[model samples]
Target: MEHLILTRDLLNTSLHQSRQIDFEIHKTAANVTRINHAFPSLEAAIRNMACKCATFGIRNHVDRALPTVSAVFKVSQVVNELGKLVSTHSASDLNLYLSLVKRFRQALTLLTNTCKLAIPWVEDVKLFLLDGTTDLGVGVDHDHPYQSNVCKTLHLLEELQGTEERSLLDQGILGVAFNKLEDEFRRLLIHNSSPLQVPSYLFSSGDEESDASDPLPPPPLPFPIVQNLRAIAVCFACDNQLDQCMSIYIKVRSTIVKASLQGLDLGYLDISLSEFDSVQEIEGYIDEWGRHLEFIVKHLLELEYTLCHQVFGQLDVWTDCFSKIALQSGIQGFIKFGNTVTKGKKEAIKLFKLLDMFAALNNLRQDFNRIFGGTPCSEIQTQTRDLIKKVVNEACEIFQDLSAQVELQRLTDPPPDGSIPKLVSFVTEYTNELLDNDYRPVLNQVIKIYSSWYDNNKFTKRLVSLEVHNIVKSLERNLVTWAKRYEDTGLSYIFMMNTSCYFSKHLTGTNLGDLMGESWIKRHQNHVEYYATLYLRESWGKISALLDNNDGDVKKRIRGFNEAFDQVYRKQSGWVLCDRGLRWETCQLILQVIIPVYKRHIQNYLALVESEVSPNKYVKYSAESLESMVTCMFQPKLDKYENSTKYTNLMGKIKNVVAGRFSPTTAAA
Candidate 1:
């Protein structure tokens, strides 16, 4: 019975030991099970942390979320460690490694979506992804292939999500970005503000060792903001969103115009000649102004071709904007310049400068037309016309003043030679010089004004005629004084005749003849004839005194007559007789009046001195001798009166009558 009790105790002890061992094994198994189950919950915790990280990264700070992101990566590493444990323990049924991997992918997806939401712009996203804060290998070890996969997958997902989100975001906000960019440009250009600078990395030239000989870098390519805006505009265009693109284009074009015009110094337009001492200085200023305008216009045209057309693919809108600016700034500026030049005291030199300014403006207009391809702007045309009219009217006033001076001189102090000839020469020279210059365009229009006056009331024609008539009247008065100043009637008559002839001939030769009517010419001719007749009568009256038939001492009378006729012929031959007809008629009248009386006296003398020994000496008073003397009495030689039909007829009648009274064949009847 004792032996039985010992065996039972031993069995109980052994049974107790066995039961403890079994309990230890079951506790180990349960703890293993709990450890195995904790991985999924840990994955859930990691995933929750990753989601929180993504939310914080996107909503709060992306570039500054590096610590949080590092924590998430640490959690992912923990997940990776857990995954390895599952693989090492042969726990395939739980699929812990796959679950961790799948959870990590979810974390990566969250990270990628956070990046996409945080940085929408493609360029910004690229920059953010490259930034050190977003490094995916922050705490991830390469020993775990899953972590490396997560890192690479995170990058791939970022790329895919970034590309997609960028497209939608760009499409949605393209117009807004472009408009903001244009507004900034407008503010800079219109307000003349400094431009914003771009980062070197974004706009690197890659040519840091620039050639020293190269020209200054072109104005920094449009600011990066503008660059980004332009890129978006192009994207919009590609998407058939042309209206938004055009809107941006127009805004940019207007800003360019404003910028170009702002570069011009419009103060030069108000320059005054009084500020300059000489025309050359004014010309220099004008040239400088022109150069400035050219520079501005050149820049504007470059923008139109290079930027506007390339970006917007249209030219008309830009050209139209350019036209308005050109008219407003360039043409109006020149117009004001012209006004300034013409404002001061009227001087011929200043007028010429104004004319030069007008020419420059015309040339500029032509250039604009060639570049812009249209008719001259209306403002330019209108301003040009106004300038022309002002210049011409100023010239007319100057001319009128000069003409008045000439009239005053004539009225106040009439010279012996008369001022009419002086006036004629002056007017001719003035008109020729004016017409010879490059003022034809204005002069042509001026002529139309004069023509209108002529057509309306004949005012211009009458004014010209009146001026010429006044001149002639002045000449006639001076001539009358000259004629009366000389006491000798023959001398006075010769003077008057020559003077009148010259005056008439001069009138016919010059333009004045047209102004003076035909009646004036006839009146002058009559005056000349009357003077010539008076000269003939006065000159021959002395010779007629010695031809009396009743005087005693016929021989002495005939000898005295011969001596007097010789003295009178010598004295009168030197006088001027401009008209051939007047001279011939004077000679003929002298012969008619003197020859008949001389012939009668000679016949009576011969009969009275029939027995005288010196009859040949007294026979010098015959008709043939008188005819030869009278023919030689004028400036140009004249034909003998006896060669004329009237003289021959009178001689024939006299000869027939005398033959009946005395013997025709006797030396002394």
Candidate 2:
């Protein structure tokens, strides 16, 4: 507080530039002359003031008995000097007064380190104190004074060069400034105290006429503003250290750009028969994304499949709660926060390259696919598209942060490259967790989201792009092999005609026809009811015709098909007997009994039970059955594949297997 006042007064007069000097002494002398001559510099002024300070007989004392004016007038002077350095006017005269601050800093350090006082008013103690009393303050906090003196401000490390040659950033010049500041900070740190220190050779020669090297120095007083200066210095040091952060940041930006470009260029190629939610126009089935769509579609399709997975009953309760949290709370909050950020960053995003921008978004959507599934709908795509449209930001959501970290790892060093064993090791841990942990609710959530969003019932997202291409190629090759098997041959042709006459309606369709035999649909359709009675009446006759006493294999095969059909209609959704011309939904009136018996003709009797009319309701109740039925519904689909030749050939394989196993003719002989 005392020195601040002195600094305040001197700051006004330190504005006039006298001259520049090379060495520390010349610099100090010139500024000292300014003060003695009122030369608008603090060093000259401080030297003159020190002379006057000694003449007035002022001693440095905060207590005891010295008169205010004579005991220590220089205490007020030192306060003023400190004030001047921090003052606005002294700041305005920065270049002219910098040397003065240097010298002034030196003088204070000399006085404090030497611990010697030279003043006329008090000589009682050898210490620098006015009367060398031991009292500082009864109630003052030590850190208080240091805290009060701090002044904070920003200082630029690099000033721009003249505008003429600037096309891009001048990293050379900018880097140098950062390097210098870093070096200065390192040097200061060696002293182990970050406090601003003045070098100690600037004090004036005192009362005796002595050589410049051997002079009695003028009295020195330590300045009390070290704490504030230290804080400012740290800010400078931090700026210097972080200067190189941009270099790495720009590199990360380019990698993301490259990925987005690749994905976008190939994203929309069409090879699928199904409609695409994102694409508006198409020329044939050959679009931009091409065969890659199959893998994408496959992963998407997997979302729809309800498999016999090992469910986690142990984790049901927690998993349920977490699912609710994810859907109802955390994700909702993120949606709100994310929208705000996206809105704000729209302008900045415009500056990024379109391809790079597209690539980044597509990459992110890929991550979502990993969590959710592959056939993301228009709504989900819109959400994803919105996300993609946004500019890449420095601050990230936790998920985004995690995604970035994962991508960083993938791009920087692919894990599988060096650790196939690690992958195998990881898979075991993963499998164990899924089997043993309480992931039931989470598992359900995952399935639900994946089914609804990621899976398009066509393919999985994991198989997108290149994988899709391979799959399509493999599928085409299989079709060619199938075509070769249908060439006609021998009396087997007569049996094939008989089978086709009975089953041709089942096997036929686009891809479906390629899969099943003819009459696939007719075999299962009204056969449940239309042929139920007739088939039942003839069951024993048909059984006798097909199997003799030695035909154990035929009996077993028939038993298996019977068991599968019986089990489905027997329990959960009981089968009903319905009359002809009555739709399955009108079963309440036509069908008298809901569950039917498999007494005579098991397969035919079981097929005719009518129940669900609505596809949705049917799906809800008969999902498992629908999946099974579709497995066989391909009969019509396959029937389209019908050639008497292929049928005869397949029957030949079956006949060979039966002959190898049984040879009942030999037993009879």
Candidate 3:
């Protein structure tokens, strides 16, 4: 027992010395060189201690051999220190440092093998060796310092007796290191407070122009965060953990989207455009939000395509989130927004905004296609087109309603201007502006709607032409109704002629004119000509009928003819004949149709009257005086008539009879 106790005492002293050397080595770099010189001596002492402990029968001494256990733990401590020191060695000095490492590792192996009793503290040495081999660090750049260290350590570990143990250590250390990196990234995201916030102007003010020029603020997170994330992704991809790397990427992209949208005030998205000041305000908000979305998606796709396929394999999570977020905050929001902005607005204003909305949708679809470049935004495009169709339909409804209201007002109220109605000016201005803008899409849609109403199964040019024809017919009906409202037939014909001329001239000048075709325009012109002829027939035809000598009573006939001529002349002279060309043509027709017959009738009547007692009383005037009065029929200002050749020849014959140059028998011949 005394011999055994002395051996244990020597073993304890050597273990104490080994531990002291290890402490000295770890204490300073100056001692690392000095202590490393003492490692050979320390190795000898630990080797002797292990041999003595092995001779003591480790199993038999397990309960009472506290010193034996302390020695085993001491060897573990020494091995840990040596591994750490080896990690710091330069490549040139690595062989020398590793020589010392080899001694300590050998001592540890001998101690464990000789003891035959498992030391719970032995795990510390194994873990230290694995860590030295892996060079795993908890810091941000975990792979930087440890790369060469891990290579060297793995090379050494592979040559060791415990291949299985080294493999297990390799896996465990890699997992822990990767997990540390993941946790750090997670903490970074959790702590990031740079989510975009809604601008105060978006919700608080109604100034569209002010908002339109408002510059978009930069994203909440700095550029470095993105760089760091990408670095981590690259590292994971390098490690062949692409799935895990993709997951991180997905999380990062989601966070970016979330941050951007947080500033958009998504709750206000459901608000109608009327809640704001104007369509421009809604446009500003949508554009602002769209810019942010565009920025994020652009960067994301750039990052994605730039990465290798192995790193970014058909990642849809980012795109899916983008689509959802953008639609929720932009397109869907605009549906109600469009309605509210256009609501209660003037028809022209409503048409402008709705068409502008369609333009915006077209631009957005193009942007989406340009950015995503695949089927990613296909659904969004389809939805956008559907929204455009809805806006177009709404615009058509507004147009139809405006037309109805104008027609209603025309029917219910007299012309405020007392000439052509205001509806003409309104329709004229509206159509001119519409065509001037070249809104062919709006025209096409309107035509489509009208065609659908006419015949759903057939959408031909004929049907569209018929629709236009119907619109003209409605106008004609309105004009005729307006004209007939006046009691005087001559005045009524003048009103119809004037209104029809104005309508036909304006329609022919517009794109609506093109759609109506040349034939339609000619039809309208013919209608104007028919009205002019009707005016002549009503006013001048009565006077011409009095020129007939059908009545046997010459005195009654002359009295009646004189009365009718005076009545027609007074009524026509007071009327407004607006068009100069129409008035001239009307004057020519009256002179041509009535002059010769009037000359013959007056010659017959005056021949009988010339023999009476009171010839002057019997005949109202001489033939020349009657000719002068007849010439003044349509001339309100005594403007000279430039009669055609036929009118000149006819007027000459009448003049000859009135001047007594031709006998009544000769004039009749």
Q: Which digits, one per residue and each the tens of the lDDT, describe model 3 over residues 418-450?
A: 245534444444444454444545455554654
Model 3 regions lying over 4 Å from their true place: 1-49, 56-336, 345-353, 369-386, 396-410, 413-419, 424-437, 441-463, 503-520, 540-580, 583-669
List clashing residue pairs in candidate 1: none
- Better lDDT candidate (1, 2): 1
Candidate 2 residue-wise lDDT, 1-669, digit = tens? 323443453334222211111232254344434433331232233334344445333223212212322212343245235423422122223333334444444444343322223222123211222222334323223243311111000000001111111211222212222333333333222222211111122122222332446433221111222222233233333334332322221222222223223433332221221211211122211222212232222222121111101111122222222222223212222223233333322111111122222333344455456433323233344554454433233111211222222222221211111111111112122222222223222323333333454356433332222322332233233322322333322112211222222222323332233323245435534443443333223322233333222345433434543454345333313111111122232222212221122122233323433443532321122324433442331122112223322232222232222221112221111
Per model, state how many residue pairs clash.
0, 86, 2
Ranking by lDDT: 3, 1, 2
Error of 1 at 371 (Å): 12
Clashes by residue pair, model 3? 197-263, 198-263
lDDT of 2: 0.27
List TM-scores for all candidates, in order: 0.37, 0.21, 0.44
lDDT for every model?
A: 0.47, 0.27, 0.48
Q: What is the per-residue lDDT of model 1 for residues 381-441, given as tens digits with 9 covering 90 to 100?
A: 6666677566556544543344343333333322232112223323333333333335435
Point out the worst 10-residue segment of candidate 3 by lDDT.
660-669
